[model samples]
Target chain A: MATNLTGKTIVITGATSGIGLATAEELTRRGAHVIGVGRSVGRCRAAEERLAALNPAARPAFCTADLALQSEVRRLAGEIRGLLAARGPAALDGLVNNAGTFTYWLALTTEGFETQWAVNYLAPFLLTHELLPLLAAAPTARIVTVSSESHAHTSLRWADIQLRRRYNGLLAYQQTKLADILFTAELNRRLRGQAPHVHAFAADPGLVDTPIGQKGTPELVQWVWQRRRDAGIPPAKAAQGIIALLDEGLAPRPDTVYWRHGQPRQPSRQAQDAAAAQRLWALSEQMCGTNNGSLS
Target chain B: MKSYVLITGATGGLGKAFAVECASRGWPLYLTDLRPEPLELLAGALHRTYGVPVRWRACDLTDAGQRTALCEALRSEQARFGGLINVAGGDHEGLFCEQTSAQLRSIVRLNIEATIEMTHALLRLRDASETFRIVNVASLAAFYPMPYKATYAASKRFLLDFSLALRQELAGQGVTVTALCPAGLPTTPACIAAIEAQGVMGQLTTQNTGAAAAGTLDAALAGKAVYIPGLLNRLLRALGGLVPPTVVAWFIGRRWGAARRDLGNPAESSILVPEASPA
Candidate 1:
């Protein structure tokens, strides 16, 4: 059954390119009002224009922001709020935290966190926290963060969550992916009692060929990616797995919130560690300086 | 028709100095920053201390809506502004590739975008009868191509060139624009720390913020196009002109890169950007 998302507004970060862009196209094709975010102004404008042209019915608006910065994320929430407010008190129905990055060399946001940590893990955490009110305002809302199967093996170092000392590009990326599922599970747990209608989910976008791996990488990494990309699936296929989480007909399992290819899968033991999720959540609160010990 | 000089980034080190200097001279002020409580405290202190008419409202200048709301508030009040000081600016010190694109965009937004938009808006809001003095807080690095501070320096250079060009464009229309280029002044704790990290070089170039504010204001009032505060800074600017920009960039890259490493985590303290004035 092809359900209509005619009046629903969904906000997706990093919608200008790669899986984010492909997901945006899928959302638009479904007749949803998409509010997309990108870092570069030119790219945002271009993406908005392209999306508009592709689907005349899809009124996709793009906001330019650097999700790596907390201040920018706060501003983005306000901008999205203002955008939705302008459209007759219509609350946001969905939030897709699909923006992820893989940097070979370590970089830092203005907020002094590792770039991958900031963009991949922290951006989603902060953006969701900031936009939770809007999510609650809806009849029912869903929060879908794009996690990875890379989350399976890796574990977060509680001592140095950011890996400030012995930084490895792959390790840092994997740690953030781990943090994503943990964050999603913890956020879902918190929202269950309070705003039960607003559910949280994690999508394991299985190794789609995207430019995320190619950008700002070492020459060796680029050489490997050139060959590795052939084995990966298309971004549109991965996008379906993400969008499936937002489907109303798709009944969720009480025990399984992690989905891949539209099917519930048991995450790693580390991802299922309730105590670890609680610890990571508390630590993230401190790092983000977010006073949302409880839902705002 | 009591007119007031509006200062952006009112709670910052140099911004606070500008506010204090203006108040001491009996210039009524309209201040704006990112936080409300601090603005209230500063306004109260300024009014109590200097016995000057001080008013403040907190605004995030980066947001166009907030800026418009602030301007609309001013317009509703029928407030007049005698001078405008663009003191709200931001910087991120690191290698270009090593910094997030968001940091790079922020430098452009705060340094270039906010300044230009505010100037355009406030110029329309200016009291035509009074001489509207415009002071843009550019840096000494504006003259050169910087490396680790590439984005910041480029933004400042944009301000420098823009201020000069705009000054000419608005010359006979009762507005005089001045670009204040200072080397180093202890404007914020982070700034002071960053300077201290430069060792003897920081000490040699650093000056009093109060004096910089005072001198720059005087220079602006006198219709000077540019004001470099310290004598050493002035001399250094002149001497730096002798070297090729490529060489200057390489030298600065090495020096500032080393200094940045010494400073450790740049943002562990507070947000460096001063959420400057709005309306």
Candidate 2:
């Protein structure tokens, strides 16, 4: 555990399990007060017990919000803001946008966005926007969006970003990862000069052995994932890179915000394409209307 | 004095929808429920969102003394009622012998006693200048004898029969009584889970709280006595009425038993439908 974590408060979505959970545990172990979030109360309660058992003095708490809905995301942001304000400073040191999904079939959330697109991409976008005031209040803050190397395989489908016209589960997932990197780049570019202390970075938690593959997939896909995951590293190892990005004191280079192996790395050509990043931001803003007046 | 539609259970899923629906229709509202905080929150939000005159207080409708206190507060304010939506009812779903005596008593007290007492109290306070409209939320399960939900079904049956009988008495007296016998309402989290546990059938029969509230109001204001929301739910009710109640009980027993297993809280699970001003 690091000695520099005292008095810091972090928020981690999907912190109930997998990489997010590991990151939350690591952060708590270092003496930071963590607010872990899960999709359901039962899951959050279970996660709370596990964290309490590991670090009783950590005094961690969990909140439940369904990330698939933008309404829920906005509400969660407001809730965290209220909670932080009541505590005193109303500042946020870190936000881990790690909650995600992988579904074999195309399903739409109540708001009509594709489930994967809604959970993986839109949630992070809206949540970050909603929490900008709190993030801005911190002397220095970090936003780590968990992207994947799979982002290299695909570019944004501008015609149908939600994939209503054509759908493949793996491809859809890869596209969200691509969108995440693009979003990080766009956000970093926007933050320069205005709020240079609040850096945005994408952490590639490379193929950790977790249950991301088996859920909502066909039996054959599950069988294949079971074999493939046997060779992958544990979530703790993957979580370290994300933690490093969050803990890094210095500001990152604006153009290179993607992190891997605790070092800055360049994303795919499409991810780094400023034109595409701007386009994606505009579309996302249109889809989920911007609540905050400032969105450069 | 201006008349405000008095809604019980103003914080629960269905009750909130009723509050929103009434406010959307420009009806001044007097909302009551168990908790002062949530009641205050919802009332403030409704007044802000819909720009309607929304007044609220906390009252445990099941307690006669509390109900009397609530009426007295209304009386002191010179509150007149042109509408009353009785949405404050609850259920404890499990085997009759398994549920605690207190739980069983709560189902009867809340679903029957509280509703009847509120109805009588509000009838006297109705605004004589405008026609009064009343909607009593019953369940489609009222038509059958359910095995697991024997007590709940019987209570809803009472509301259904009581509403119809009251309608006959109030006919041509510038007041209309409506029985809202909905099959399943996707109002609260627990109810949504229960509906999902039933698979495709649950998905089909269940109605959204906002839409149901709006449509039920439309039907009630048009003087429709019995308004069951969905065509399929109404079909199920009509078809269910043809079968002997004994057979219906066995079928519902098997169906709910399966849903309970899917729910996976085996020791003893109680669900609250969350309507009415049981604050």
Candidate 3:
């Protein structure tokens, strides 16, 4: 079932590859204006060329930023605001937080945060907080954060939230994914009953055959990952869960909802905890140094 | 071909216990740590005592390049790992705002990032026909909010969650992930001091490193999702669940806040103490 997204503008991070790229292609094919965000200028340009080739009339755009850095996220947000403003008010229809990384070791971003925590969680957090006004300018808007089923593994560590005591790559990645869900839930709660009808959702695309967990991995691990990728679902198929949230025909669920295969699915108890969600929201705001007005 | 149990942080107190416990089981061992001398000594002792093959690698798990190098070495050796015990973790005890960026980053890298990479690398080496085990060393701190040990507690929380989540993800593949959440272990001088400072609560909750390691491995092999060492620790964890997190934070803040005072460090004390009224 194809849904037409004509006359709507959407921004997707990590739009150069995997599910982000697939979603961009799908949205552009449906006649939506897509501003694809990528890490490298070359990749962004390449993605732009590919999108152009796929749909000549789509006029898809591309932007570049290292989402791991707060300064870069702020800059990218400003660029997006400028682009949307030039197109007049009520331009942005959706924002997708999809850029993420799975590190094989503990690495720090330029801003001094754990790499996975910075890129996968805080980057989207700061970007969304910065772009809320633009989103609110639209008649109806949606924010989608790409989370994972891995969130079920742990609850929030309120004391050592940044993992100052111990570090594990998978655990760090899980923390970021859980943060994505909590962030979405808190955003939904704050935006509910507000004018402009903004909606926030977290989506699990399941394990798609992507280049994730390949960098810095051993050949044997890569081989096993390749096998898993072969058996896993395709990125295009996985991306539909995100696109479904943008569909107006589907009746709206709660403000903060978890979606899988285009249907709402229950997340972990921690992910659903209102108190944790609120606390995480406050902490995220403090860490990112952005208040989105009401949140402060 | 005899399979080995790979253990990280083999130079650490709990890591040593896991090594000894597995050696007693007559299992071949592959041990890694940042310091080569301790790992080599441990490996030689284990080999002589248990008559089992012991391989030692001196590599810093916090470095991406080094981690990749270690993974490549394991692949080239065609090493088959039947079990992986992630026991490498440390904590920077202070208000999160007061800690140096490098100190905080090291904790995250060592505790969370290194464990994930090591597990992924070793999981690739698993023999599909045999059962595989993974025991992650989380802390009972994973269950509560500790203001003074914020990042450390959060990292353990991550481990607890990741272990349970991976358990389900790999259940069909015959791999079991277990999280060991021990309350306290006086493993080092600093740990001993911290435990002593906690007074009665620490006395009641602390467990021996060897017992915790052995129990954790047994529970992991039994396919248990979580293993909290010590009866008191388990009971405290249950009680923790009943209290509101805010209350837990408040209580822990008071406890750790006093410990910091005993250490005579006021720089990190502001997080827990209420501010003084203006004159």
Candidate 4:
């Protein structure tokens, strides 16, 4: 069924490449206004051009920010808010927390958090918190956070959440992915029953062929990702699951749901735990210094 | 043939030290790490200082695909490694139950899986006629059954045993495996804090990262099977061998327990302290 989204505006992070870029293309093609966020100016401009090419009538917008840095994330949010305000109230229809990185080693951001944790988990957490007002202004808004099946590999490490004591690239990636699901669950819980209610969901795109592991990876690591990419679906196919969540006509589902291949599936027990979700929410707020009343 | 000495975790404290030491010796180098910016900076500095060819790639070694791609890339570049330094290893310090499954998995993947895979791949890429030196960074923890650092200690033990076995197996092929088992080295600020948390023992056993790197390479080139850096660390390893595994674990657990207490319960604090409610 072709869903008409002519009046809606959505923001997507990491929108210049992989599934993120694909999702922006799909949404814009469906007549929705896409505010694509990317790191590099050149890439963002290119992505904007591609989206415009996809739908000449609804030209997609682009914003540049390094989502890895909290300050950059805050600035990006302000820019998004400004755009939303310029379009009048109720402009934001959806938000897609899609930017992520798999650091091969433990690297820290300027903010002193692990790079994977900061970029994958905290960036989205902070961005969502910052943009909640714009989302709330809409009659109905949705949040789709891209998580992974790798969440099952690890639960939250409260003690060394930043992985300061021990650091492993894969483990850090898993921890951040798990955080995404937990964050989605808690956000849904908090926003429940509110006017213009917000629906938060976590999506597992599965392994798709992307530039994520193509560079800056060990030979063996690259080979493994390549094999997975060979067997995995393309980014366009994976974007379907995200697009499904953003479909307003789709039947109302649970406030917090994990979507896999465009279907709702059970996430890990830890991901579904309300208490853990709450804890993660609070911790995320603290880590991001977003403990202000804005995210209550 | 353009020969290079490849170092994993090359941007890290001990890894960086090893890079500098190798550069001092005028060895053409190839460094790999997760961070490209620092690796590039290090490579450029080394090249300028030593006038040797320095190359680097940012790679996540835990991913099997990246590892394969790295091998292919090196092969395509016609790169031959005369030495392989597996200096990348990490530990999540806490009770095993308190640690996340991800942390446990990382300890094994980076320390054991990545090490083994890198060695296997590089062994195929090394010059057959040349004497190849391999340095695997183990730890004094490898000699003990540590409680709080269970996974890390176990992974180091794997490296130590594997290095010894491989050393003997590859002796005929002119390859030497040197397992560097040093106690606390104040490599990073976190490591320095960890050492301080152990009180007197950590202070007494701690070795300078530069010295440790220098000593390990020197011993590896000398065909030593194992290199323990500090005298105090060597004595402790020997003493640890004299004690029963249970007894050693008990003592180490007590020490780590203190460290954990001093570090405080970061998990509890974050969860309990509520954020300001949304207006």
Please, what is the whole-model Cα lDDT of each candidate in the order they appear?
0.79, 0.80, 0.79, 0.79
Off by over 4 Å in 3: A1-4, A193-196, A218-228, A292-294, B1-279
lDDT for each residue of candidate 3 in A1-296, tens digit (9 for 90 to 100): 24557768899999999999999998888878899999999999999999888877778998899898777898998899888777777458899999989764344443335568889999988888788877888888888899998899998777556452354557778889999999888788778745438888899888789988886533444676677688879999988888888766664585538988788899999899899988888777756766545445
| Candidate 4 C-alpha lDDT tens digits along A162-181 | 56445566787889999999
Stretches of candidate 2 off by over 4 Å are A1-14, A22-93, A97-134, A137-296, B1-3, B23-27, B48-51, B97-104, B127-131, B171-174, B186-200, B253-279
Model 2 / residue B184 / CA error / Å: 3.5
Q: What residue runs in model 4 are displaced by over 4 Å at the alpha carbon?
A: A193-196, B1-279
Among these predictions, the greatest TM-score belongs to 2
Which 10-residue window in model 2 chain B sums to the lowest lDDT? B270-279
lDDT of 2 by residue, B1-279 (tens): 147999997777677767767876789999988888777756665565456798988998878799889888888888899999999898875678889888888888888988898899889989999889999988887777877778888998999999999999999898899998887765544665676677778757866565577789999889988998778888888888899988988888888877778888545555454531110
- Give the winner by TM-score: 1 or 4: 4
Best candidate according to DockQ: 2
Q: What is model 4's interface RMSD? A: 13.3
Q: Please write out the lDDT profile of model 4 over residues B174-278, one tens digit for every residue.
A: 799999888876655455556556666665676656567778888998999999977877777787789899998888777777777886733421111100000
TM-score of each: 0.54, 0.62, 0.52, 0.54
lDDT of 2 by residue, A211-251 (tens): 88785454666787787578778999988888787775544
Error of 4 at A96 (Å): 0.5
| Candidate 2 chain A weakest ten by summed lDDT | A104-113
In the predicted model 2, the residue pairs found to clash are: B8-B276, B8-B277, B9-B276, B9-B277, B33-B279, B34-B279, B87-B275, B87-B276, B88-B275, B88-B276
Model 1, residue pairs in steric clash: B8-B277, B9-B276, B9-B277
